[model samples]
Target: MRALALYGAATTLGSLVLTALTAAPAGGAAAPAASAFPSFQGAPEAHGTELAAGRALAAGVKFGKCPASEELPAPIQCGTVKVPLDYAAPHGRQIELTVSRLKASGKDPKTKKPVARQGALLYNPGGPGASSMYFPLVSGMPEWKKIASAYDLVGYSPRGVARSAPLSCMDPKDFTAAPTQSPIHPSDSYKKERIARAKTYAQGCARKAGAALRHYHSLNNVRDLDVLRAALGERKLNFMGASYGTYFGAVYATLFPSHVRRMVFDSAVNPDPGQIWYRNNLDQSAAFESRWEDFRTWVAKHHKTYGLGDTAEAVQHSYAKVRAELSHKPAGGKVGPGQLQGAYLQAGYYDDVWAMRATALSQYLKGNPKPLIEQAAPRPEAAKDEENGNAVYTAVECNDAPWPTDFETWDRDNSRLAERAPFETWDNAWMNLPCAYWSAPRQQPVDVRAARGALPPTLILAAERDAATPYKGAQELQKRLPGAALVTEKDAGTHGIGGGANACVNRHMEAYLLTGKTPVRRAACAPHQEPNPVSLDRHALPKRIPAAV
Candidate 1:
């Protein structure tokens, strides 16, 4: 799942496309080797091939100027690390993964010279397909100033992601060539159409990406991360991951516990092997429904400002009315029921945008649909990136674990959930429909449990009301990782907690990263205050809203 901004970087909904452990040691003490741990199911043996690849990356990376990006304005260095396309055959074809770094620099308080460096801190911003090459630049943002000054901030585009042998399914124009189709349709005909489209998309991926799709699962991603660690010349990895990234960190820790220095998992995915992905998506749908109620109530409480409703039910009616009207006649010939739902889905992920979204709804109700239209309109320029993200999302999720091949199972499960949780159930189902027809051979889900006395102290951050990765998942991760600590933002519904507006959450994260000090086993922080109502000026809204996987 795509995470909200890791350190409050401004991310549009378009950018985010849309884990666990056990603990043994504390600090950086060496743990048992990979052979001492239980084997990961369907994982290639950690022998000659893997070791050779690691040695190759240890030759070191040559830094150079990074590609220009308005999204990443910091003076960052970029390079690539070559790894096997398929780890099982490391001597075969190689793929280059794009990497970026923001070298740490800060003066010592006592001495006039630079402070001693604290090693590299690698970041993965979720997306089993999101390009994290810009994350190093994101680390340079003020929210991460302390961490950035201590460690070299690092980011990379994982296999099959942008600048890393990106996977492509169809032409960029095809993404916006047709009017958006709402996934909430109740008709059997609509289901058939969606299934057909899913098949077509899957076929396109097979045609374009070919056999390389088979090598893009979590196991390889974990392997790639290790190679990256070697390329950085770090004996141990200091890391932070959010959303699906939490799972990535968990798998890496499981396979290479001795290599972990300090790690942080924000908005963790459920670590149960049974919930690899499909069941987790269903759970996400229900959680989103709950968060949506939170949004509705917020709008109701501020009814005077929005004028759309005075009660939660009234707000729901207003939303339903707007969705119906958009279905019949799309606003500005672009934003349809599908686009409208996509726009509002952001509210389920973040409360910061609630006021602006509510104001847009009010304007639409007043016959001025421009605000709503602007919110949902597609950016043709971003279509290619979106396509790459979607392709990787399906490729990794589908390849990472087993998914039911039958459409009937998906239809029944989602149809039943949609009755009670209407906001994101259908939309999420359709987003993952491509998985049902995925052509890549699937692997068994990684058993994320770590060996006894193997892992180091890990910190997990979550919001009690997170919709993308629910609060329960964090609790589950805490259970799975023996010595880990969980710091929750009580009653908060935001997807990503660390490096956010919550000072308490940031304190816990900074403490853990800077000093390897974890909070009490189960700690809680007060939620950030809910946003106050605002005027209808779209520009007045906060530019950043956490995007979900």
Candidate 2:
């Protein structure tokens, strides 16, 4: 499954709202001392009593200059924390986690005095593999100003991610080395090819990552969160997680209920151990199919601008024509039926890009392939990062729970779903197919329901029509967390809905985070209006569309 993509956007209120866009232990063998690295001047000092068993681990953190990033406009402190690779063997091998922080304070314009601070708010952008280190970039946005002044916004690249003892399954070039294969194809040969590809990828991971693959599951990640909490000197953790991060937060609260002060789950994962991961992906297929229909309807309504079709059926026909053409001769010698599906997959996540995508399709049908090629072609520079994300995503999910070892079961299940939920069924199945051949031993799913009454009043946010995490998961999660409230973006289908997409939802989140007041048991906020074709801005298209959540 893909995690949430954290993007920043300025709202009408002049505040920066985070918009959906899309652990472990100490112990084992001795590692290098923190003092060996040069210390950063004026960085916040570690506080709070350290864990009795791993006091040395918590006390050894040292901060330094962060890697320069074009994504981050302001400088933030960065550091590494050593964590036990296997919590059961605390004295065993250790791995380093890259941590970053945007402090909670700024000068008051007139008085030029510093604002008071109120603990820290840690964030995870849900990729199981996504890097959260750049999350603090939202600090200067108006919507984030209040939260920024009150709490230090902290982020970290979890185990197996970039600069955090990164994991790799194959060389960067190998990621795209395979010829494009369309998931929509129904032939037996296609299935055989996909299975072979999945097995090859798994073998590569085993060859390269070795034993590290077994340690990147959710359990170790939750343990790492505790270690980070202690390192930050906070007795109780304050966190906001989206997509898979919701699952991460729920597991943390279950494992360390006493250490949670305030937590938020946006676009929550269904916590039913029985539904975890496999069933959940199946759910996404149907939901995404529905959202795709919504997109076709929207494009149909704007036929004058797109000239593709004036009915959803007609639009779909136009799309099929483009797919057939691509399958015959890939646009720009890169985009094929598979790439075409990949580019349009963004429509299932966020409707904001509907016009841009529709425009690209319309242009392609009119004999211009530039727009479609630009949207579908992969960039060489991003190959490494993309590979890293996929590796971690596969490793964590595969290690976190048992997947059917037989290919026959997967084929049967997905083939049934493909009949009705054709849009994402096969593609999603292929994305997770590597799990069947995963080398690591699987662990049992964490029982989040075990934490029902033991947690703080956490807030949960979701869009009713969210295809990625699906709204039902949010409702399921609410039942699993006793005091948590569910705030729904009524009639909306976007994934990751908390930062500033809707003012009503934002108000509820702010109230809960700032004052510990959970909204009424359930709340609903009117959805954002659909995009207008007449006023659509072509240049506003995101350079890269985020993958599934």
Candidate 3:
């Protein structure tokens, strides 16, 4: 996906490609001791030997059973970690999160004169809903290689997302979470009913989730990490969180500050704790709409390439006509207004992607079914198919704080805002409506104001253009945290400062993780200074899949 800007807020990908990598974590007691910096204790990077060894290890394992080592992604090595639904009361009930990992490659168990072996580095590709376990051992994010050289890469299904205690509402239909029926245009009464419906949705989740719902909060996931840390016997944690994961990373640091070793939070999340998640989503909605206009304008200017329109207004009208049409009778066979809208929502996440999908829509405007048909089909499954991260996201997000019981507030707030942020008003509402009736009692989001304690010195990353996690949020976090340094990217059109190809960001992050060096003085990273993107040779655009097929 072309990043909308150098910095972006993490949102759900339309359908990110998932490919296989190192086998799932295999058993064999974790190597007992941590290694010194620059010490290569693992096998060197031998694509052939390590690939062979990894396959051999994978071939022998039974599925659904995770070994103690959180460092391989073989089908046999991963199973589940049963954890209490709620962290406040850990002894009561339990839910399971499927976890996976890539063992340090290049390690020769025999000579022990390791080729490369760094500490464990856990990663998350943000989505309050995206799964981390599915991130290719080598994702588009470049830092994976720096950390991957010696350390184990850990990934897991968070709670209430795709796999871990998956939050299934209305079968697959609800996955779109848009209006089931075409929504009536907003009116005072329409707004009122919308509020009522939202309340009902929240209540329904509460009823369905029962006691287990309480366990799904950011703190609990942190607790889960504590458990995993103990289970893996890692003395401290190293983490790389993008988008929603950034917020998750922050929560973890706040709750268990001492346990942190090194972390990179990219495309940052606003962790103010007071702002509602839906409200945050609203900000993203507004940003996306603005970007969409830019896209329309760009397309209009390049009518020959796109054939959408020769003027911005014409292109906007073209897109609006589709919106209006979908608002009434959806196009194609099965996609409804909500699905179309949700797909539009999916379309706007990255700048690079919007144009391609927009072009696809442009082709659709000509009455070709290919674009619309592609939009209606299910996305390709991840090569190493693991559960997506919906459960983990909801588990932690729902528990992090409480929502207003008054549905009127929700309706009043969203309806009024939707008028201005038409692109994502109700869509964002439904994306979060489940919280209204969340089954568990809402735990107050942690009031985390970081104080420089003995926790490891950390690096904070922010992209000035990031809308999902706004640069201000990252700035605020950097200001509050102790022993932390901040890095910013200016005039860039992608999210996540340290990820992707920017060498400026990569070099600093590399030095930090590889040598325990935090950016002592804050610096700026721009696209020109960025490293070449991963797979620059394979310039496939971001893939946008149907909301639900």
Assess every candidate by TM-score.
Answer: 0.90, 0.88, 0.75
Q: What is the lDDT for 215 in model 3?
A: 56
Best by lDDT: 1
Which prediction has more favorable lDDT, 1 or 3? Answer: 1
- Ranking 2 against 3 by lDDT, winner: 2
Residue 473 in candidate 3, Cα distance off native in Å: 1.2
Worst 10 residues of 1 by lDDT: 13-22
lDDT tens per residue, model 2, 215-287: 8888778878877766665656899888888898898887667668899898888878877788888898889
Ten-residue stretch with the least lDDT total in model 3: 1-10
Off by over 4 Å in 1: 1-45, 69-71, 108-114, 183-185, 535-548
Candidate 3: regions farther than 4 A off: 1-76, 87-92, 107-116, 139-143, 173-185, 188-193, 276-278, 310-312, 376-396, 437-439, 528-549
Write one digit per residue (lDDT tens) for candidate 3, span 33-84.
2111112133221121222222222333223545553344453246456555
**Residue by residue across 467-517, what tens digits does model 1's lDDT show?**
999888888888887789999999888877778888888889988988889
Candidate order, TM-score descending:
1, 2, 3
Q: Whose TM-score is greatest here? A: 1
Model 2: per-residue Cα lDDT at residue 309:
95
lDDT, residue 295, model 2? 96
